[model samples]
Target: MYAIVEIAGQQFKVAKDQRVFVNRMEGKEGDSISFDKVLLTGDGDNITVGAPAIDGALVGAKINRHLKGNKVIVFKKKRRKGYRVKNGHRQALTEILIGDITIDGKKKSDSKKSEPKKEDKKAAPKAAPKKEESKKAAPKKSAKADDLKKIEGAGPKAAEALVNAGVDTFAKLSKKSSEEIKEILTNESSSLAHLDPETWPKQAKLAADGKWDELKQLQDDLNGGKA
Candidate 1:
C-alpha cells in the first residue's frame, strides 16, 4: 500500500519501510511522528481519495537523521545600475522512515482523551461566560491585526512587533511616519533596526484603501522596501 501525504508543507508518495527526506521538522533522531494530512491511499486495484485531506487517516514515520541540503547560489543584478548581489543558502532537511499507514483508526498521540473529558465536565458550567468573552474579543482583534507580511520586506517577526505596538492594521500603519516606524522597530529589537520603512506607509495606505493593483505595482518597483 502507498499513501500520498503532506509532510512539512511538501507532499510525497510513501509506503512502509520507505525512507524520505523532507523539510526540517521538530523532533530528534529516533523520535516518531505521524502525519494526518493524508491526501490519498492506494492498495492494489482499490483507491481512496480525500476532499482536501482524509479524516482519521494517518501516516506514521520515525526520524532517522537531520542534515542540510546542497547549497544554492542566488544572484541578482540591475543592468547599468551597478547593482549586484550574490548569496548562498542551504536548506535544512530531515530523513524519516515511513511506517504503517492507517485509516479510520485512533491516533497514537490521542492518549489524553480522559483528561479532556474531566476538564470539559468542570468547564461546562462556565462555558457560556467564556463564549461571550470570546465572541466580544475575537472580531476586534481580527479586525485590528492585518497581515503586515503582505508588505514588501516585512517578515513574521517584524509584523508581530508592529501588531504588539498598536500599529496592527494597515490604516494604523499608514498613519505612522517612517521615522516613527523605524523607532518602533528599533525599540522592539536591535536586529530589526536595519529595516527601511520609507515605503511601508505608502504601501499601507494603498492596502488600507483596497488598491491592491496599485500596491502590487508599487511593490514591483521597490527593492527590499526601498524606493
Candidate 2:
C-alpha cells in the first residue's frame, strides 16, 4: 500500500519501510511522528481519494536523523550596472522511515477537530491581557474613526484597518510615513491590501491641524487617493 501525505506543507508519496527526506521537522533522532493529512491511498486495484484530506487515514514514521542539504551557490548581476551579488544556501532536512499506513483510526479525525480548538483557545487567552488596553483606547477610537475616514485614500475599511493597528488619533496618523501606513494596511491578515495609502499622511496632517478646507481641496485634486 502507498499513501500521499502532507508534511510541513509539502506532499510526498510514501510506502511502508520507505525512507524520505523532507523539510526540517521539530523532533530529535529516534522520535516518532504521525501525519494525518493523507490525500490519497492505494492498495492493488482499490484506491481512495479525499476532498482535501481523508478524515480517518494516518501515516506514521520515525525520525532517523536531521541533516543539512548540500550547499547551493546563487549569483545575480545587473548588466552594465556594476552590481553583482553572490550567495550560498543550505536547506535543513529531516530523514524519516515510514512505518505504517492506517485507515479507520478515530484518533486521526479527533486530531483534526482538536487542532482548530487549540488555535481558538490560544486566541481567547490573548484577549484578556488586552482588555485593559481596550478600555483605555475605547473612547478615542469611536470619534477618531469618523475623522480617519475623511482622509484621502482612507475609506471605511482602510480607516478600520488603521484603527485596529492603533493609529486612531489624527495626530498619530499624521506622524506615520506613507510606507508605514501602507505596511499597516497591507498586513497579511487584512483584506485592505488593494487600498492605496499614498495620500493618507498628508491628509492626516491637514485634519490634525484643523484645516478641513485645505484637506477637502486636496481630496478634490486626488484621483481615488492616488496623489
RMSD (Cα, Å) for all candidates, in order, is: 7.3, 14.6
Which 10-residue window of candidate 2 scores lowest in summed lDDT? 188-197
Instruction: Using lDDT, give the best candidate's number.
Output: 1
lDDT of 1 by residue, 11-59 (tens): 8999999999987777889999999989999999978888778777999
Give me the overall lDDT of model 2. 0.81
CA lDDT of every candidate: 0.86, 0.81
Against the correct fold, how does model 2 do in TM-score? 0.49
